[model samples]
Target: MSFRLTTRGLTIAAIFLTVVVVGIGVALAATSTPQFCGTCKSHVPYIDEYKKSAHRDVNCEQCHSKPGPFFFLTAKLEALQQPIAQITGDYEKPILGYVLNQSCRRCHNNDLLFHPVSKNGIRVQHRHLIEAGFLCMRCHSTQAHGDAVPPGSRTYPSMDQCLICHNNQFKDPQGQVATSRCDLCHTKPNYGAVPLTHKQNDWATRHGAVGILSTCSACHVKKGACSDCHKGILMPHPAAWISEHGVIVGKRGGNKACDQCHDTKEYCKTCHQVKMPHPAGFVDSHPAVTAQKGSDTCFNCHVVANCQACHDLHAAGDPRAHKLLGGANSSLQSTPTPISSPIAGGG
Candidate 1:
């Protein structure tokens, strides 16, 4: 018995849809909460410190009084305030030395923090943060207190903090304060900012030289003035380095800039002394002669020293008389081994 009634079908569908909508609404209501206080995101310091704050009288509504919630709401209010300010020209200028006075006045303002010394008043007049119109939150508080952080609520400069702003470099060995964050000068302090000059020096063609761009900058005291910044051995070409390199018994550079990174003799000997490419039988036949090949690391299998032997550290270009791994003492030469097949074992 099929009775086709169009109005009844439409009514039934609407009722089912209404039930589904109400069910979804109830589920959403159960899970959500109303943000009445707006304190969920940034409330800090256990509510007690805030109550003790000098601005404790200032309501959350006066500053945070705008409609809606969160940063987006604040931003919209700020945009609207800007236009109103333009029309009215009313900028909310903070009080001068405001934060210090407010925080100090919270407990001791007139005579209590200091002995009310008139001479101290002369010294206190030099307060830069006060002149900067910074609020207490700007340089000192839980949210804003790294040494590098700009002045805020969580920040309180120590005694060394004064010297950090001074022209002279202050070192507090006690580790109480690290004033490295303060700019010595406007010049950038990062090591990576310096350019690498050594790469241009012909070594790039041979062994594929590479170095960190900032390594040189770390030693540089000031930007661009290499001589003024680094003195003595720190200089690119120290007189001491030349004196040491010239007299050393072993061949240097061989067009290899080993000295750039390595500061000592042991670095070269460790590898070269072990696996020098001399004839395989030479090690067993003449251990003393093969082992005694100083800086044998450069000597390749040809029985003669390679370019590393005679290679000039000063000027890397080829000269007519230049030979690889300069002439070794053949005066104590080893006898050559007879050619033997791999199948014919040597005793």
Candidate 2:
């Protein structure tokens, strides 16, 4: 009886092994066929094009399969995967800007698509997308939907994105930007937006000759060489002052730069004024503070008042102390014209 049982068991094991081999062969045949109906996309449409892609030879079953018993369960799973197979037909590589299936870097590239770099010759270190837990789908598209879409379908994010972390990048420690004088570096630029901000008819847009934009540091640098224009703190003409200091800030002489050395009435005195004390009346100040330690033009302490100190040009109905600095640049020193510039905050 024992011998008979052993022979019977050996025969059963041989038949089972043969059945397993045949099942494996059948699965391979099914996966290889271009006309298979039941398995993951065996045809691999656009096979020639995929052969040239970076994701060449990545099989469809690898992306849509799970291991299980081969008979009824596998058949049911394949039924669930049919629509997925049909929907992903002839598609290009979907997952862009990330690791390859072999787990290698995809975006470690030599060709720069939009590599961020400093305005100077500095290389901007990019953030690691994988380490940050952001997939390539964060900035790029996939091909699982249909045919591959053009890369340009997405728009570049604006500067507002940088404000997320560098919230205070454009503001001071107090959270307020210093000033935004548009005409500071721009002699005349974009005058369109001014009307939007103010209730005036504005010629505010100073769009330059094609791709020229303004930066924060462009006009705010302390151009302190205005010593020749006046013997004191520099003051610009109110008509030409820019309140926003952006690239659209206009200049006075039809250029995109501020007059670092001159005022509106006179030329850039720093470059044009060869004589000390000026030729005659380039900048006439009042109260004759010339005898004092430091006082030249009306900017002695009157920059806060604009051109109001030198001439009351307007006759408003008030006890206006708005008068010129001196009495025609004659008698260089006397009782001191006793006139002060206008007030700033209701002084």
Candidate 3:
């Protein structure tokens, strides 16, 4: 009535069990490799780029797989759908996947997160962000992988993302407000380590006008930064620039660039009084010139009110003073004198 197994039967069962175990072990090992993942054409470029990454030595599954043995197996099973979706053309282009924070914390361990390193009224600290439960991947999109991203896609974290939390509004757990200040998260920009924007053509001249000096000061200790090279003057102008700037402005036809640093009208009034860039002898010569050349030359620097008020011709109804120097149209007829020396030598 009892069941019995012969020697041949036991041997066959043992051989079959060994083969199944070996097959499963080989399959698991193969699937864990970056090579097997790259078999999907969509992943080929990612794998190639990852080979050059800081994480080149780490297995793909290490950062990709969920923690725990049970979840690890579950992740492997879930991954099978990737190749199937790739074949069926149902996968999203620029293939999207989230890397969990636990996977990152497995290596980054929070001990070194709050190391304070300050430079010029700025400090870098991440303990607050971590305590707030922010994911490391939130700020470091491609920290290890660099640009190992899909074609035409950005793999790095955007400045906009940093600004969202680091802006002037949001307060932290300690009731301290967040800041968009650059030095809070970055060290000083060194000799060759200056940002790419600073290195671009004409950045030195254009940066102030662009109104991003605060952003620059984040990494640059901007106190005396410009004056260091500019010799105490942030703007580029010669010693006699005050006396000569008018001709330079006139030649350019407009004062758009001048507006970057100076309120051109009010600034001119500071030194020129009724007559701007006109020299000491210009007052005497201007009358003769306006008589010969017309008052439009005066209008280049002086407002119509300047002429009317100065000449005691500001009547309520008519600007009769203009008639004495001839009407506005008279300038077209009168020939302009060629001065040997210009005001500022045409900026």
* Alpha-carbon RMSD to native, per candidate: 22.4, 23.1, 18.1
**Which lDDT tens digits does candidate 1 get at residues 1-347?**
89687998989989999999998666433322222222322223323444555545543332322333454345344544444554565655321112334533344344543342223112232334344454534334432112222233245433223332332343234433323333332233453432344445664432223433223333334754543332212334444553464333245434133444443354444333444344688535443554354423323223443333533443356453243235643222233122121211111
Question: lDDT tens string, model 3, 1-347?
Answer: 98588999899999999999999778877998988998888887778878888788888888888778877788889887888988888877776557888887777676656665454433546676677777766666675456665334445444444554665667777789777665456555542445656677888666765434434443445587765654344443565664566666776566654555556655443333334435689756876766654455455444555565666645556666546755553322122222121332111
Which candidate, 1 or 3, has the higher lDDT? 3
What are the lDDT scores of the predictions, listed in order? 0.38, 0.37, 0.62
On a 0 to 1 TM-score scale, where does candidate 1 land against the true structure?
0.22
Best of the candidates, TM-score? 3
Q: Mind sharing the TM-score for model 2? A: 0.27
List residue ranges in candidate 1 displaced over 4 A.
1-46, 61-123, 130-138, 142-153, 167-347
lDDT: which is higher, 1 or 2? 1
Model 3 pairs in collision: 244-343, 244-344, 248-346, 248-347
By lDDT: ranked, best first: 3, 1, 2
Model 1: weakest 10-residue lDDT segment is 338-347
Cα displacement (Å) at residue 144, model 3: 5.1
Q: If ranked by TM-score, best first, what sequence of candidates would result?
A: 3, 2, 1
- C-alpha lDDT (0 to 100) for residue 143 of candidate 2: 27
Best by lDDT: 3
